[model samples]
Target chain A: MTETESPTGSTLTIGVVKETKPGERRVALVPKLIERLTRRGLKVVVEPGAGAGAQLADDVFTEAGATTGDAWSADIVLTVVPPSIADIERLKPGTVLIGFLAPLTNTDEVAAMKKAGITAFAVESIPRISRAQGMDALSSQANVAGYRAVLLAAQRLPKFFPMLTTAAGTVPPAKALVLGVGVAGLQALATAKRLGAQATGYDVRPEVAEQVRSVGAQWLDLGIEAAGEGGYARELTEEERARQQQRLTEAIGGFDVVITTALVPGRKAPTLVTAEAVRGMKAGSVIVDMAGETGGNCELTDPGKDIVAHDVTICSPLNLPAEMPVHASELYARNLTELLELIVDTDGKLAIDFSDEVVAGACVAGRDEEVN
Target chain B: MTETESPTGSTLTIGVVKETKPGERRVALVPKLIERLTRRGLKVVVEPGAGAGAQLADDVFTEAGATTGDAWSADIVLTVVPPSIADIERLKPGTVLIGFLAPLTNTDEVAAMKKAGITAFAVESIPRISRAQGMDALSSQANVAGYRAVLLAAQRLPKFFPMLTTAAGTVPPAKALVLGVGVAGLQALATAKRLGAQATGYDVRPEVAEQVRSVGAQWLDLGIEAAGEGGYARELTEEERARQQQRLTEAIGGFDVVITTALVPGRKAPTLVTAEAVRGMKAGSVIVDMAGETGGNCELTDPGKDIVAHDVTICSPLNLPAEMPVHASELYARNLTELLELIVDTDGKLAIDFSDEVVAGACVAGRDEEVN
Candidate 1:
């Protein structure tokens, strides 16, 4: 495919940089997406070793028509995470920075972008509206975390996931309980079911019982509903929390594997399994705390460590999406491409409209000098 | 249930001991089988922590009518692996020993059993007849290994095992190859298929092509059959080996995950995947060398360690059954129970008929002092 497509000969230069976040292996874009952007009259430049973490070689990007250059010098710079302050200073004014910027919690990053005159689009801030569903990086990444959590649990569990009948005897299937019915929880439930486990899911929102059943998992009712805005679970009241805890403590003991994915945006994850509950679980049971990085939902979960408390193994895996970099980057890159298609015009110029809900929601900084 | 049940008032004592071999965590018996044996007029004794590795607590064993005692003092001492010399010293004359005694390979252990006057039954030496299938410990453990191999590969590979379609895009299913059609290889093929991988299996014996296809895997006919006696693959001639390697090197490059379980009795495992073949694999692909302890099927596999060669991760896990001790012990304990039932009469006394083929095949050391 040729790089020049527009008759006006107008094109934009886009840059892809290697992420510097510790243990973050995913890239914002891959070579396949670079080819797609370049074929549309967009000049693509990738920093050396930009795709190394995702097992993509530099030569492969070059082969796909991406040139090696200083990523900060391009008209638009793409990254998976927020860039370092030193890297951000290298970008000239009017440069657009696109990434999974945690705008709600990263007050300092939004201020720096505004002061530097860098228009930034936070992919995490993509609205939950149907129109912006294709560009939702948070949901896409969480899907990967959910799938990985099941694999991690299956590997750590002392028994087989599926039931099997041999000449010697028959083995019972493992019972898996997924806490929360978000994108990650749904995926975890589906993955566990696919592995032949008897998957059960719990969510405070009673409405999600159908979604849980749709994924072939039984719904766990704790008799307390905490449905909140934006499809997230609300913080529970003191009395509701005690009731939920009491019910879950008794139910958790029966499961061989437990995966907790209850994370409230910009806040500590709700405690699902307390230390006393861990003691109640069977000896060979395993718990995968998916929200470990944001202060786990399991009280005994030690973030980024595997602990055997009361004979139950608790694996608090952090950054699961990064661990499966190939698929994670592929999904992230596609999300970036869809978002770019929305904001970049046919002439390869910025076409941001303040009236557009997606633009207004995801735009953390712009020419208006708005910091938030 | 009472420990004594037979009208003759004779109850044989069967002991369960903790395996002393390094990295061996499986127990010959579990609490469930203890209840079964005790109900059948078999007095069960267990060493302290005998089933701890298998997640069967001491209280559970006692609840099943088993008493804590020196395992060596029982009428029959059961183990997963051969007992140590120090343990054998504690056994009185005429005590029966049972385990997966690799009699053909471990000449020293066989001699030790004969010299100590320990009548030993080798589970590995059990006849492959249909009637003796319940006593096949080797096949039971291999089944666990095969199932675990796919889980290990899915966890290590940087992609999803099954094909997935989401709002973002579609992920193709992982391609898996099983090099062997034995118990382990068949289980691996079945597991890979269960996980939604497109699986293919290869075997030197053409008769097993149907068995491979039955497990939902495509049969790979290498066009060179080396079917041997006793259900094992025969060693290939020099020229036959060259042709097989040539064809496999080309075929192996196409798979994302390769599980090799080709093992010849009393011999080193065949080299199915060479170093050159690993270089031909995709960067994020994985190879599980199931025969790691007996010299791996992959040339670069380091037994009990994971190595990355040519961007392909090679995992040579040893004793996968021990890693999932709960079911491993359950199957093993049942196998031991079935074997014991064959030798012990209803009166709980030894019934060694020289004409019986099952006993003749499995008896490694007996009153005749025959060691081998």
Candidate 2:
């Protein structure tokens, strides 16, 4: 955590708990993260071994000057991942718990958090924008996920990606296709290009062709736009899906490796590739679904598993962010630190102004409005 | 069929068959397609009941001056769909058959075409260039697919796409996300923008930001360009995938609807949306996977089916062009006609030029090294 100057005197209490879930090793708050809060007259606490996987120990927390007190004593409890029931019970009413709580998926846990009288903040819900850049835990993690997805595709592919001037016969470059053109898709495209795979991207938005071309791959157009309001995909009609498939069928069966990064916010993913389409591809093609944990983009894909169809391997990794925990954590820390700084007022204090759009948009727990 | 007067002396043969596949009533080739051949002095055969689904009748072929043949015979036999074995066997050795035979998925079947000594041409393989514009079957179908994709998404979504001054109150227009940014993707963007759906697009290629913005949607940059040679998406390194997912996860939960149209040529479609990502999406959100025929970009997608997951509906319909068969077929016919015109000699004679890249690329089946 970097130092933040405070013009006025104020104090904040921050708490940390050891990860309790099986195979869970990430500290809710990291060492540098704790340091950032403490330098600003904020109190920090640790329940021993919080940052063990990250190589920080109890002594490190103490050195940071975080108080080792009962979980309920802190004015604010900093958590890693979501806090478990046992951990939640330890907190007193009205304590603010900040973490990546599974608020949407785990409604029961949200209920528990509300019942315990805790004001909860979900880091995962932070939006991606210039103002919220510092608070985007997902961006940091996704950056890593995109890179990992490409590596996985390369590993699964039988041929090398780049053109090789080897002593043997000159090696032809591999052809790569990026399904989605989002952050992961862009990373996959860049990585594929860097690895020497001829990469092209397809999107329902034709405007991305130039970008795909800019990345050095011919943008294969299958002409299907489902753009709706707010820059999101609209529900497709029955006939339209069929048309897109026809165009896709013409283009889907020529690449050696494909990495997909397309996703709809707050909805089930649309099936871009069908089993029939899979059957059309040549044997030994590899596909990496970065969106696998939610299920997968591939019809034959199994979450957290790799399956083969028509001699092609479809990989769906669930916890891609966890795969590269170090850098992911570092980036996440930076984002969180930035977000926290925004709320810290002129005096060394935290403020949640419900009237502001930023605060109101993220305060989904409904405590302020009692909607939840 | 449009009249083709390019081939004055030389005659080419055309073949037609009644679509046998269920729901496959539209003939792959149409009258306008034959017009160019007729003008090229090509003789064509039509099987009874072809083109009935598209409201075209055998008399339409007869009226076009094409001989209705009991047995398939001709120097060049034009087909709308993949030739059946019986259809293949029906052809004499050294006959030319052209249509979207799907060489990528039907390689083995195509290999059989070679064994049967049938000269085959896959129109879908036409390169993207000004010279090949007339022959670009993909573009023709994609235009329709794009138009249809937008309409589909608009209809399925609960909210209206266009902003309206309605009695129900000034309704905020719907929000949509177009996952892939290809030709179809861009068209979708433009359509969505026109239809009043505020649309945004994501692509691995950074160059597409302008295109997205051009179509009235914001471009979210992921900071990594996976582009390699020719502006194609480069295969990403492992680290990149992680970062990409982290960013996308955050972006995915904010939109109302998503249309994913990501794919690779001759490969299994890459997975874009994860089941986890979908869980964060709101109920009533919709996803249309234009790449559904090639394998879906979504985790919960079942190609050729409609799926409801996490209270969201996912539609992956293959054969989109078939739905708008009239317009799609007409466009395809025009393109075929243009290519045929380009293939004619100054004296209106058929010129199977091996020197021409457009002819060479499109004429996949060769006779003695010459494209013809």
- Highest lDDT: give the candidate number: 1
- Among incorrect, acceptable, medium and high, the docking class of model 1 is medium
Fraction of true interface contacts that also occur in model 1: 0.71
DockQ per candidate:
0.74, 0.01
Best by TM-score: 1
Model 2, A72-153: lDDT tens digits are 5576676657777877788777676777776667677778777887777787665544566556665555655666677677
TM-score of each: 0.95, 0.48
TM-score of 2: 0.48
**TM-score of the B chain in model 1?**
0.95
Kindly report the docking quality category of candidate 2: incorrect
Candidate number achieving the greatest DockQ relative to the actual structure: 1
Error of model 1, residue B240, in angstroms: 2.5
